[model samples]
Target: MGCLSEESPSRSMKPFVFTWNGALALIVKVSIQPCVTLFSHPKEMASSSSSSSSSSDIGVILNELTCPVCSELYKEPTALPCGHSFCRVCIEKSWENREEDTGYVCLNCREIFAQKPKLKKNVIVANLVENMKLKEGKVWLEVEVQDTEHGDVNVKEAMKSGGSESFCELCNGEAAKRCVPCDILCCEKHLKPHQQKGHKLVDPGVKIEELRCIEHGKPILLYCKDDESLMCVTCTGGEHQDHKIVGVEIAHAELKDVLAAKYPHVSQSMQSVASQLRQVQKEEEKTENSSRDAEDSLEEKGRLVCQFVNESVDLMKSEINKRKMEKLSLLGKQREKLEQQMEDLRQRKSTMDTALQDLEAISFLQDSKDLLKRLETMSDFKSVKRTPLPVLDFSKEENNLDGLIMLNKNFLEKIQKGPVEHPEKVAEGPVEHPEKVELDQNNLRRLYGRSPSLDPNSAHRRIKISRDLRTATRTGTENQYRKHPDRFDDFLQVVSRDCFSSGRHYWEVDVRSSRRWVIGICSNSMGRKGVESGLGGNPESWCLFKGNNEFTAHHNSRATDLSLPGDPKRFGFFLDCEVGELTCFGDSRVLHVFWGNSMDPVKPAIGVYDGSVHFVHLVK
Candidate 1:
C-alpha cells in the first residue's frame, strides 16, 4: 500500500514512454507499484550510470529520460535554447497550471525565452527512448514467469472455442495471452512488446484461428453477406469488392432476428404433429379395447342365435371367425402404413433437434434447407384410418342362415348400432315384393324414369331441389356454392342420376307452364363454371330452349331456331349414343337433329328460369 521497498523488482523495470505523433505511450512492466523516478542532478545521474551497462542497462537510461517538468517518462520531449529539455505538451500544461507563462523560466535552467519556445519534437531523444524501450522490453520479457492458477493452455480447444490466448508458438510452451493484431501467442516471458500500443491483447483462452482471417491474416471483424462468409476489413475492397459487408455484431443481431421470426411457425407445427400422434396412440388403444369387447359380446350373442335356429354351434363359430379374420387382415395393412409414417416423423424430429443444437451459423442454415424440403412430404401423412368392422345384419327377417353371415343392406348400420334384434324366425324362402313404379300407357316411363333424382350434392347452393328431388328452383340472388371440385359454382344447371352410352334413350320434359327452360344431355366432362357451363350452349352440352314462346336447339354454343308451328307442351328428347346423334320432337313431330362425335356415356341435365319445368313421369 505504501511505497514499495527499494530492493523490490519494480525498481528494475521503469516506464518507457514513446511518442507516436504526441501521445504519451507508456508500457507498464510491473505487476505492483511503478518506481517512476524524479529527474536528478548531473552528478546523481553520473553516479547512477557508473555501473557497467548490460542489455538491461537500457532500463536505467530510459528512467533518466523522464520529463523535468512532469517527473514522468519523456513524451514529445522538446528543448529550449538554454540547453534544458521537457515534454513539449507538458511544459505548456505547467505554464497554464502556474499562470506564469510570461515569466516562463525553464524548470532546470531558470532561463526564460523571449516568448514561449517554439515546440518541436526532440527527434534524437524520441528515437533513443524508443530504441532503449525495445531493448529493455526484450531483456525483461525473457524472464517473465507464468501464473500457476490455471492449467496448461490448450491451443486446440482454445481455437475451437474462440477467444484469444493459447500456448506460445515458439517453444510450444504455455502462454498467458495472445496478441490479436499479431495473431500469435506469446508466453509471459516474451509478451512485453505485445502489451504496448498498436497491439490488442485478449485472454489466452480464446482460439487464434477463429478470430483471424485466413487469407489476410487479420481478425475477422466483419461479415460478408454476398459470400455468406466471415471476413476481415481488407477483404471488403480486395477480394469481395462491392459485396455487402457488415460488422460482425450487426450481422449476428440481424441473423438472430431472421431465425427468431420462424420460431412461432415451427412451434405450432410441433404442437400440431404431437397432437396428431397422441390421437393415433388413442386410436390404437381404443381398437385394442374394442376388439376385446367385441369378442365377449359376440360369444354371448352367438349362443342365442344358434340355439333358436337349431344350427351346429361350431359351424356358426367358424363362419364368424372367418369374417373376423378378413377384417383383421385389412386392419393389419392399415396399421403397417401408419407405423411407417410414425417412424418417419420420429426421424424428422431427431434431425430437427440436431439442426437446432448446431451453433455454427453456416451449418445451421445450410442443413435447414434440406429439412424444409423434407417437411413438404409430411403434409399428408394420415394413413391410420380403417373401415368399421362388419357385424351381423338382422334386418333381413326370416331367411337368416344361422351358420353363415352375409354383407347385407344394413351391414354397416348394424356395426354402428350393435346387432339388430334377431329376426323373429329365419324364414325358409325369400319373399318377393310385387311393388313397381307405374309405367306410361306406352310403357315409356320405365325407360325414362329411374326416378330422375337430382343430386343435391352436385347442385349449386342457390338451387333448392324439391322434396321428391324432381324439381330444381334457383333463388335470384347469386350466391357461393359449397366448395367442390366438380360442383358448378357459376351456373344454374343440374345433373340427373344415370348415364346412357350405347342405348337410344327417350325422355319428356314438360315446360308448357314455364317461361324459360332447358332440357338436354350433358357430356360428363362439361365445365361447371363460367360461360361454358350454360346448358345447350357449351361444347359439352346440347339442349332445347324455350323462351317467350320461341324454341331453339343449341349445340356448341350456336343456336338453330326451330320452325315449329307452336310451343310444344312436352319436348321429347332422344339420344342414340352409338351414332352420337340427338333428336328432339315437338308435338310428336321431328323438330331438330344434332350430331356429336364421341361415343362416351352422357347424362341428361335440365335447367329452368322464371318458372318450373316437370320431368314427365307417369303415375298409375
Candidate 2:
C-alpha cells in the first residue's frame, strides 16, 4: 500500500497505536490509517473520516490474530493439545531452548507432554488471520478512493459510503453481499457477476470467511472423520481423498445427537448422588439427636438418685436428733427429783445442829420440839430411797446406727461401682453331679431365702389365715376380720410380712392342695382395697396363675399363656432387685419371668380363690 503525504504542522495528528501488555511487542505499520488527508473539501474530508473508522475496525480484528510467542499475525500457526495456537517456528524454538526435564510444553499454557508431540495446523485461526489481512488491503483501497478531491460530490453517494461496513474485494466499495463459495465480500455490481458465475451469495453480515478453508480459501464442504478436521473440496481431492468423510452439516448434526442422548442419564446420575448425600446428612442429624437425648437422660437419672440418697440421710439424722432429745429430757427429770431430796435432807440436819448449840432453855426447848418434829419427819426420810441414776449407755443403738450407715454406704458404692464379687465364692469349683448341682444351687439361692409369712392384716375377709400365719385358705363363709387399711378387701390376695427392697431373695409356696391359685410378687405401693389391685390386674404386680387346668403369667392386665405339663406342686420365685427380674420356678422348670425396673420394695404374694396355699419353709 502507498500513501501520498504533504506535511502540515498545524493539521498534524498523532497516529494511534494499539498495544497489549505482557506479550511480545505487536507493531502494525499502517501509518495515517485513520487520519484525515489535506483534502480541504468538506465532502472529501467526511469520506476520509469514514475510511479511517473502517480501518480502525480492522485493527481490532488484527489484535485477535496476534500470537503470544511472536505477537504478529499467525504464520504457519500450529496448535498444541492445550488448544493454544502459536507460530510453528516460534513454538519449536521455545521448546528447544527449554530444560530437558520439562518435556515438550505449550508456550501459552505451559501444558506438558511426556514426549515430543506432533504439531497440528490450526485451520480456523489461519483462515481468520488471512481473511482479516485481505480485508485490511481493501480498507486501504477505500481510503485511497475517498482521498480523491471533488468540488461537488453527490450527497447520496457520500451518505451511502459513510458508516463501517465490509468493503468489496474487487472494487473496494462498501460490500452489499458476501460470496460463500469464494469467501469474498462483494458490492451490488460485483454480486451479480458472482451470482452469474454460480457462486453462492449471502447477506454481507454472515461470516462466510470463517467457514472457508485456510489451504484452499473455499467454503468447508466436508468433514474428514479420520483426521477430525473440516476440509474444502480441494482438500478432499488431495491427501484426504481416500479418508472417511461426510458433509460438514451431517457430521455436526450427528455429534449433536450423540451429546443429546447422553445428557439426561448424566443429569439423572448427578441428581441421584445429590439425593444420597442429603439422606446421609439426615441420618447424621438423627444420630446426633439420639446421642444427645441419651446423655440428657443419664444426667437426669443421676441427679434424681443423688437427691433421694440425700433426703434419706436427712430423715435419719432428724430421727436420731429426736431420740437424743427424749433421752436428755428423762435425765433432766431424774436430776430435778434427786435435788429436791438433797434439799430436804440438808434442812433436817440444820435443825438438829441448832438444837444442839442453843444455850437458852426456852429457845432450846422450842427448838427441840421443832427439831423433834423434824426428826420424826427425818425418820420418815430414811424410808425415802434416792432416785436411781439414768444410764447414759447407748451401745446397742450406736452399733445399730453404725451398721445402718455402713449398709447404706455399701449400697451406694455398689451402684456406682457395679455389683461386688466375693472372691472366695467365685473360687469354689462347680458341683459334678446334676443332682448335687441342683441341691447346691438351691442351697445357694436359699442363702437369701425369706420365710415369708402371710400377712393377716392383708388377708381378704373371705380368706382364713392359720394361727402360724403361714397358710391362707379361701372359704365360702366370710371371716369376722376387722376392716384394716392393709387388708385385701376386694380379692383373696395376701402379701408376705417381709418386703425385699435390695439384693436377691428366693421364696417358695406350697400350692399343691389348691385347685386354683395365684402366686407372684407385688410392690408395697400396690393398691390393697380396690378391685383393680387383684394379683396381676395392675402394673404394680405380676403373677403366675393356675385355674381350670390352664397356667398363665399376668402383668399389667396382660396375660401370657404358659405351657406347663402337670400340676406344679410348689412354685419358687427368685427376685433380683438390682437386676429387676422375677423368675418363677416350678418343681423342675421355670414357668415364666417378669421384669420391673422400679426401685420400690416388693413382697411375695399369694392369692387363693378355692383351696389353701402354705408358705414353704425353705431355709429350715
Candidate lDDT scores, in order, read: 0.58, 0.65
**Over the stretch 273-375, how does candidate 1's per-residue lDDT look in tens digits?**
9999999999999999999897887687667656744654455667667878987888888888888988988877887787789999998888888888877
In model 2, which regions exceed 4 Å deviation?
A: 1-441
- Which parts of model 1 have CA positions greater than 4 angstroms off? 1-166, 169-179, 186-507, 511-545, 552-569, 572-615
Report residue 613 deviation for candidate 2 (angstroms).
0.8
Question: Residues 168-262, candidate 2, lDDT per residue (tens digit)?
Answer: 65445678987664445667765764454344567878766576788866556567778899876556557775676655655788789999999
Q: What C-alpha RMSD separates each model from the true structure?
A: 35.4, 18.3
Most lDDT-accurate candidate: 2
| TM-score between candidate 2 and the true structure | 0.32
